[model samples]
Target: MVDADQTFVIVGGGLAGAKAAEALRAEGFTGRVILICDERDHPYARPALSKGYLLGKEERESVFVHEPAWYARNDIELHLGQTVVAIDRAAKSVRYGDDGTVVHYDKLLLATGAEPRRLDIPGTGLAGVHHLRRLAHAERLKGMLTALGRDNGHLVIAGAGWIGLEVAAAAREYGAEVTVVEPAESPLHGVLGPELGNVYAELHREHGVRFHFGARLTEIVGQDGMVLAARTDDGEEHPAHDVLAAIGAAPRTSLAEAAGLEIADRAHGGGIAVDERLRTSDPDIHAAGDVASFPHALFGTRLRVEHWANALNGGPAAARAMLGKEVLYDRVPYFFSDQYDVGMEYSGWAPPGSYDQVVLRGDAGKRQFIAFWLKEGRVLAGMNVNVWDVTGPIQDLIRRGTPVDTEALADPRVPLGELAGRD
Candidate 1:
């Protein structure tokens, strides 16, 4: 147990940081806990900001993780609108902003998370071009959707990732002409592989969303201060009223790097290196959520997963570790996305070049199916479209590393929960 007066300083008040603070209180470590957030509002959930919240299906107030009174009742001091500038490891304190107000901490949890990567192409700074990352970004895009009057304006999504597809669905729901530009052969090609990605490509196409596969955007052009069109490398130009860049995100690790922590070099981007326990190079300083590159047990390599599940799970795991509890975080990674009236859920690890077999249960055309990715004879990962019930059993089988009959897996009559008994 930590000392009653021990100070725990948590940076970034996103889901990860907020959950960590809540978890600490729930776990009965009632020391002085301070949550430092650059945003003025209380901690809010971000997942719905891209879908339900953007579409007006969910209220903005409902997105809050906790009410203000909840924090006060828990004795969790919130330092909202406070930016942590740097960490003084030697002094065991963190400096905030230009004023350099130092906050001492016995243990520090870095959940700085990530920011949306911006396109460097010309006309990217146009008024109609935007990137969806924060609540404010979504609010601005939602306002643009209102001003554009759905059917009259065109929405051009520059990336085919989850966020882009989500926004595409939202825009389409509002009767906007939507087109998604992806340089890959299929949407989500990098994550779901070509075969499964084709399923998404077909789904989007059926919903009247145009796809420009294998097309690289050369530049975004604008008329006056507003975005107008986008030109591709193949010399093809598409008229666009609004441009959404969803290429992906980069870890927000500048503060940690400035604090003299060793940053991990990632092929896709940079992140903080941490052990299985989520402890950084400095034991006192732990990192979790999107900013940390964690070791994946199934893939047998370090990976950085930017998802709501990762942030929620990793945050609490790091908090427990900071409290001197030894726990190895090796749960199967899971993520979900909603688009065009379909809910897509995925679980487990998909290592490149490892999967040799993919068994499909149910028909993809019907938009209700479970695709199990198998490597050798064991389940590596599984993706479900409009089938969340099957994910629970598939995730269990993946975690257990169980082998199943490929024929049985393909049979829709066979309950997926029974697969574990087959082993």
Candidate 2:
């Protein structure tokens, strides 16, 4: 048990850090807690930045998790615009940027999250090329979108992942001609598999969004410090006024390594390794959210999830463990994305090449359906596009490791709840 006045220092004031701090206080700990964030603003939801927030449909004040006054009331110190440079485990303190202030902590939570990856191709440093990872990036992109009016400019997205596709939908909604360049055969092929990827390709194409699959980009070309076009490996050029690189993000783990903590092998790029209790190799320190690469019960191997759900759900789990509440973080992974008018929801674990049977429910032609992935006889995961009700039953089946009848799942006449023996 920790002393009443023991300090808890949390790095990276994004969703994970913010939620962890709140959870610690809610758990009845009156200990001193400090949250360090590089950004000036308090914690705000990021998922809306690509959708409602970027489109100007949602106000910034509405997206903030809590007002600045709330932090004051809770006695949680907010270190805005402060960057933690290194962690000295031996001294039990962290070094921040030029402030000469070393924060001492009895327990430390590293939620230092991830940043969007950038392409190293030529002309990447051009004025019109940008990566959407933070609120500042979204604000800049929103301004650029306003400058380029309807049917006047073209926006080229570098990747076909969720971020790139969501941005593509938003750009299209703003009346800009949009094109997505993907090196794979289909969008989200790496994650959703080819069948679901085809559905996404069809959905985007139906909305007049152009996709160049199996095309490898070689370099970005610019003139007068502004992006102009992207050249492919096949000697083909595509014109663009603005370029958004939504390839993916990498974990911010430099401080953990600098502190001489054991780093885990990279599952999805290079993320920090942690146990089921969210404890790092150093027992005094814990890692959560996008930075922590954790072992999945379904996959039988460590994996790193980039969804907002992971950050929100996993952060508190780590905090509880630090407070001596022993529990394994085994919640089924889930995420949602809003693209155009479609809302896609996914749950459970789907390891690559682990599924033998795939059951499709509802009508994809009508733009509403759910796809269930089964390994052997048990349900492993399910992806629902514009179908929200299917998530609950699928999640239950995944949790119980229940064997679903493929025939019942594929038939729209039968309710999904009946297949899992829930109803």
Candidate 3:
């Protein structure tokens, strides 16, 4: 039933791709495994790029998913710095690199990941304009932050999302001036909503970070090919020596699109549409991580998560599914953020309009609390700030899908386990 002569080709060199290769081997697959990555660097986790590494608290080597020698030892054919230009689904092969070399595969996996969205405004091409996505980008930004810190330069950031806010915290730690321009009224409004978003706003404000809310960046004013200021649509100019665009990232779907794969629409988080088994429209091909939008039986909707944990768990699950193992990926969506002195972990999906009420546990003023978004009386999502070791219970509350009492949920004396219908 198993073919040793078969070859499994994986596209994309991010965390998901690398872990899939590891899982294939762990699953006792003896077939040839080829992993192609456009980046020359080894497969690395992305969280560090915006957090520890950017803050100079993590070593460069700590970001890699595996040691450099691990691939060779595992017999994985790693094609670093190579781009797969085209996929031939009918031929079961891919055209890669400038020479157009083709590699055939019996099975394929796409973990192509995403790229930072670019600013269409003027002066984006100028010096001192930066984005933090790749390790190289973090390295460059780290150097820039050091220079800005040393010279007391003002760094203007566009977007108040996770990346923008994390970078702002790192900039403040480096003693650089930071001004964040966000279209939303509060930081993380799209995710945490206004109530908790205001908490982050206050946290950053306490650290001397300036926020210009309810405005979009109109242009990055520059002179002599270097940033000078950022102008907002509200006709206000914010002085700056550098600009960081943390607007967000868009899924890289060109290869899948060209191959005629069924891609999910924007309303469902645009990505290659995959089934519960991570199988795409083409049965021979599969997708995982940020690029694959798959149905969540628990959430009752198709979701595409761009966080590190998805890649950490999704790859192995996809690999097992490829190995003819029964797979049902219903893991609760999870993500965490660290800004200034506050750290938080969020579980489940509770976007605006999806929840009826937000209940709080512990102290909000002290930045130590758990915020729960409830639909009717059922727990939909929970975020713990400056709180530790409650991710398990929070996820349990969401997965159980049972109504929880707000009074018991808010009472600090009540054990979280007792509230989640657990013994």
Best of the candidates, lDDT: 3
Clash count (model 1, backbone only): 0
Estimate every model's Cα lDDT from 0 to 1.
0.86, 0.85, 0.93
Candidate 1 has an lDDT of: 0.86
Which of 2 and 3 is the better model by TM-score?
3
lDDT of model 1 at position 370 = 89
Residue pairs of candidate 2 with colliding backbone atoms: none
**Which is better, 1 or 2, measured by TM-score?**
2
Q: What is the RMSD, in Å, between candidate 3 and the native fold over all Cα?
A: 0.8
How far is 68's C-alpha from truth in model 1 (Å)? 1.9
Q: Rank the candidates by TM-score, best first.
A: 3, 2, 1
Candidate 1 pairs with clashing backbones = none
TM-score, cand. 1: 0.96
What 10-residue stretch in candidate 2 is worst by lDDT?
A: 262-271
Candidate 2 per-residue lDDT over residues 239-293, each given as its tens digit = 9888889888988898898887777776544677888999888888999998998
Per TM-score, the best of the predicted structures is 3
Positional deviation of residue 299's Cα in model 2 after best superposition, in angstroms: 2.8
